[model samples]
Target: MSWARIMAPLSGGEGDATALAAAVRLAEPFGAEVAGVYTPADVADVMPWMGEGFLGGVQTTALESLKEAAAAGEAKAREAMSHVTYGKNAFVSLQTPVWSGLSAESRLSDVIVFNGDSARGRGPLAEAFQQMVADEQRPVLVARGEFSVGGPIAVAWDGGKEASRAARLALPLLEKASRVVILAAPKASSRTFDPTRLQAYYAARGVTAEIDILPDSGDAAPLLLYAAGKVGAEILVAGAFGHPRLQEFIFGGTTRSLLAAEAPTLFLSH
Candidate 1:
């Protein structure tokens, strides 16, 4: 499928540009419209409340400060949007109550792009990433670090629906890649597609790919990432694998616990 409209949520965080960069890079080959969305905190929600007394001057001052903070975030987001203008269709939107606003916007867009900093308790960005992955179940582009994005894509295949879904969403990038490597974890329990079959599938699409079975290491996810990196891949496409349990996949379930600078930009679909 082609990505005609891409929505990137820019928090103006430590590595927000990675998502913006991925969206812009993908847009060039597909001519997609990139929208840089900013979701700021709600001032009212963070304001202090009295049990049964009227508001005082202190509370009023605190409310104004929170409003200014939110406004400042929006301003920074607007400024960040200026750095990316490759397709002549880049735009920005500052949203409120981050999670709900972004989730709603994601429904209207083809893909949601965000920084892959999914550590628990980090902030709203992490929470939004989890909600979208677990609740929304949409295709997400998690920018782990700086990446070429359009070149040398690696598909972390497990023969499951999630894996195939990720591959499908990543088709535009894969087609444009100088090389595509199908990385498989044979030990993965829920596999469905075989490398030979996947190879033929890509062959029909006029894309040549090399299939390599990763060793049955103790941990499959990190090893899979390791193999993809070894192949000089710039992007790693994988399914957003998740199950209802405390323990999750190596690449992190919807929580994105596995993101790191060393890892390539991830194109994940569940």
Candidate 2:
């Protein structure tokens, strides 16, 4: 059986309810479970720094805001579940860093759903998003405009451990795809593609695969994006490059451009 999970960032800008709703729809057929996450509002000022007379007011305001946010999250979670089609089965839960302890648990999920914004909890631009993908070693799907996830899929492969991992992770969805394009791109080290070997890999798994080889260009992101769109790919799955220590590689040029691109990306990092 196939399973999927969507991580709603829970913020006014990036990880909000809209993305969660779309994630719910995407997970409908798979009967996936979804989790909502929100960063609690800052209350340190009210706790020890405020005057005794004003402390009560500050505490009340903070509590009210927290309640509102929690209520909104619950309502959105309910709404997301309402759109499910495959027997309308989905389990929803809310978690946080200090209280609900969701932050620790997100590392264990298979897939995380995040937004492009920087300030919305641990989103695509945040370190948590990268950790969720590369460090925690899971696939992260970033939500963008129009939220169309199911369609033609593009698989970026270099025959490395990372590329193979991405291909394997994408197998479930690839089997469901009407068309699957296997893209072999240029990388630094000595890497070659054995069409026969790859064909056997897919053949063994019952996937009739179509392959293409592209030149090693300076920027792989745009090239991959262009190729996917040309093939009418709605969901693009690729092995994410860049070392976790190098900020330039993680949140810098290539990653930013790819995440900012029009297509919804399923990223697996090495």
The candidate that achieves the highest lDDT relative to the unseen native structure: 1
Assess every candidate by TM-score. 0.83, 0.71
Query: For model 1, where is the 10-residue window of minimal lDDT?
Result: 249-258
**lDDT (C-alpha) at residue 107 in model 1:** 89
Candidate 2, residue 210: Cα displacement in angstroms equals 1.0
lDDT of 2 at 152: 78
- In model 2, state the lDDT of residue 58: 60
Clashes of each: 2, 2
lDDT (0 to 1) per candidate: 0.71, 0.61
**Candidate 1 wrong stretches, greater than 4 Å:** 44-61, 90-98, 118-124, 188-193, 249-257
Candidate 2 clashing pairs, residues 3+ apart or interchain: 7-113, 10-15
Candidate 1 per-residue C-alpha lDDT over 1-270 given as tens digits, one digit per residue, 9 for 90 to 100: 477888877665655566778778766667788888876665545534543443678776877787787777777777777777675555555444556677787888887877655423255577667666667878887766567645788888777777777787777778788999998877654545578788788889878989988876656677777788898887888876555524564434532434544467777777
Worst 10 contiguous positions by lDDT, candidate 2? 116-125
Residue runs of model 2 more than 4 Å from their true location after superposition: 4-7, 12-15, 39-100, 118-127, 146-150, 187-190, 193-196, 247-253
Per-residue lDDT of 107-156 in model 2, one digit per residue for the tens? 55556666555412344236556556656666766665554545678887
